[model samples]
Target: MPIKGSSKGIVGRVGSLRGLSTALMLGVALLLVGPVAAEDFPLRDKYASVGVPPVETGELAGSLDAMTVVDARSPYEYETLHIRDAVSIPLASRDFNESVRTLAEESGQPLVFYCNGVTCAVSYKAALKAKKVGVKDARVYDAGVFTWAQTHPEHTVLLGEPLQSTDQLIADEAFKDRLLDEDGFYARIQSSTDPVIVDIRSQDQRQGVSLFQMKDRHVPLTNDNRELGGLVQAAMNEQRPMFFVDATGKQVRWLQYYLDEQGVEEYWFLEGGASKIYEGMGLQ
Candidate 1:
């Protein structure tokens, strides 16, 4: 009924229409469901993520799953507040390692060590100790309880009397050149020179072991060494000396090394043990 040219043109148009229909259907199907292709990140793949072998600093910030959070703090501090289910292991105990080994033997979990915070060195020391005792998976949570409290206020934190490191005592200048021995510390206390006395021993020693020699201005350095950040920041705010005092001068020396890394000014320390203070007081 149509001319030859017209019929041929119609057939060609019909064929084009069919091809377009097929292409649309295919596109729609792919859009609805198809395998997603992604380009691989060569650098990330090579590094094996952030928390893998030969590097551990990045690992400590990871989730708490499957980890045994060891609170390397004093028992009284531990009782006040700690991560729920965290095992208390005081750093001052001679049998600290034994306790850790027993805990590991009982539960056999990965260890995450924590104390006061960045300023507190006990947690780092404890982590190093943990690493020595076949707990290859141990790492330090340098933030400690203070950071934890800051970050997780919704969670419960045990409260108790505040503790301060012995270094703070020497920094105060009242306890400068004073012997740190039992007799020396008490004599200074009796003199009421208003010396800031800091006892580095664990809570057990403070309550049960022996009566503190100097009760004047006593600051208890809690197990949560991370909280000591407040002290450091406060010192920085006040432009006060971040000094050191301990049973021996060892802790202050270590603190000096740490403060040096922080670009802190010079910190002082007593040359002899605290006992020399007693002798200086003529009480030794």
Candidate 2:
């Protein structure tokens, strides 16, 4: 039940660009296909059928007291910055339908969905989906959290510490910049001073020779693992940095983002995952 796009499998497949910088290439790719403008919000013709209307930022601001504002972005995005009192129900969640239904049934106010910006479609899609499930009053505040922060900084909220802008939040949530190559990871584990490695691979995946001689703790990543939070909390309470590893470095991204949302900031992931470690140590 990890959110879509959470796994390493979904990481952008950058074709060979040996001469070009990876970061620069990523930036250009994002620029080419990034969020659309407010004017270009998708499914414009279908809004009427969905019975969801677009709520302008100003209107949403005025009506916050009267509406149930739901952030429809990923947990990472929601934790980074959101409307002061909005609750998050990410569009990517497997329980999204149930969450929306429960919120609709419990709250007397209309549901308002918002994400990063007008270009982001999560809010719109969430609103539509909610309406499809009988939440007739779902609304999309397409202006998004970033726009709200820019216009009404005092009315924003963040997960852990205060940040000045949405850009900072994006930077903080970036995983690629924090990835540890095999050598770096090996060095860290050998030192055993700072980060405590947490292997999230499944039991089957751990059947053979373990990386770092299996010195790390095993905590399988699953959507409904109730104990996962407790395990992470214990690590945080001990004030130890966590470094996560999975089969292919994909699962750790989801785990990392989830940890970030929970206010656990001191963490990193092994680049290319356990496979990389196996290859590096000639275990492969």
Candidate 3:
């Protein structure tokens, strides 16, 4: 299957392979893409010899009582929504080895790692890492949070808060207000003198983008972005309204929570993000 959010052009190009199994199709795509250059693509071959077998969603659902589930996505992704009872231990974290060791010692149960889905390599890498560190039973739930959310929404948890239906989440006023549309964001930038626009897009994404000119600072939104807490502190010290934006606006929700933890009260995120602004301004 075409990766989620892949363009129609890509889908049409891959249409001839519709008869292939999803795993086979993904393998073909990976071959064409060549290695896990992007964060979204998983390094399936990296752990091929690690012997971390794929666990199906159905098996995971049935085996939850006997296994410990670890979310290999970032804490932000975990907090946004995750398989219920799964512990967050981002694969890319410095503390990953320690976390796995702790989890193994604490639970003494089989550990399952999962991120976005089969398309994401985090869980595979995480499982391999765990095995390398002597957690012999580490396994990858190949069908990850995306599949779990679709097939078992009731088993999903959000932000350590009360379990909420998708509709309820949409209707939440607090969640709703965090989003500022292109027009609203433009007006805020133009009129609001106190709030500083914080561009959280990757440095690569920021290149040649006119919106970067409006930003008071640039901090790429990644779990490994060491400058994140410092940036948050700087914004807090200034006590200015903090406006955040990412490539698609989704990542800002994670940063919003980060700001909240840092005691930031005034913040907003661009809805639909820089892409929307580019579209609105008729820029490529």
lDDT of 1 by residue, 1-284 (tens): 01000111211110111100000000001111233222211222332343322212224335554666677865544444455446667676677676667666655666677765444567767766766766666656655654454344333233321222212111323223322445444444456433333444324323432224444222334323344445555555666553334444433432332333344453344555444554676856
Name the lDDT value of residue 175 in candidate 2: 63
- Model 1, which residues run further than 4 Å from truth? 1-62, 159-284
Candidate 1 structure lDDT: 0.43
lDDT of 3 by residue, 1-284 (tens): 11111111111111111111111001111112233343433455555676987776677889887888887775546645667777767786676787787777777789899887666777888898998898979988866675576566688764444344544232234545778888887787677656777788767788856475645577775543457777667767987677788887656645654565567787888898888888877886
lDDT (C-alpha) at residue 142 in model 1: 56
Q: Of 1 and 2, which scores higher on lDDT?
A: 2
In Å, residue 96's CA in model 1 sits off its true spot by: 1.6
- Candidate 2: misplaced stretches above 4 Å? 1-49, 92-95, 160-284
Give the true-structure RMSD of model 2: 11.9
Q: Please, what is the TM-score per model? A: 0.40, 0.48, 0.54
Local accuracy of candidate 2 as per-residue lDDT tens digits, 118-202: 5567788888888888887988887666567666656775443343454533332376766898888777666655557778887
Cα RMSD, each candidate: 27.5, 11.9, 14.2
Models ranked on TM-score: 3, 2, 1
What candidate 3 gets wrong by more than 4 Å, as runs, is: 1-49, 162-196, 201-214, 218-250, 253-284
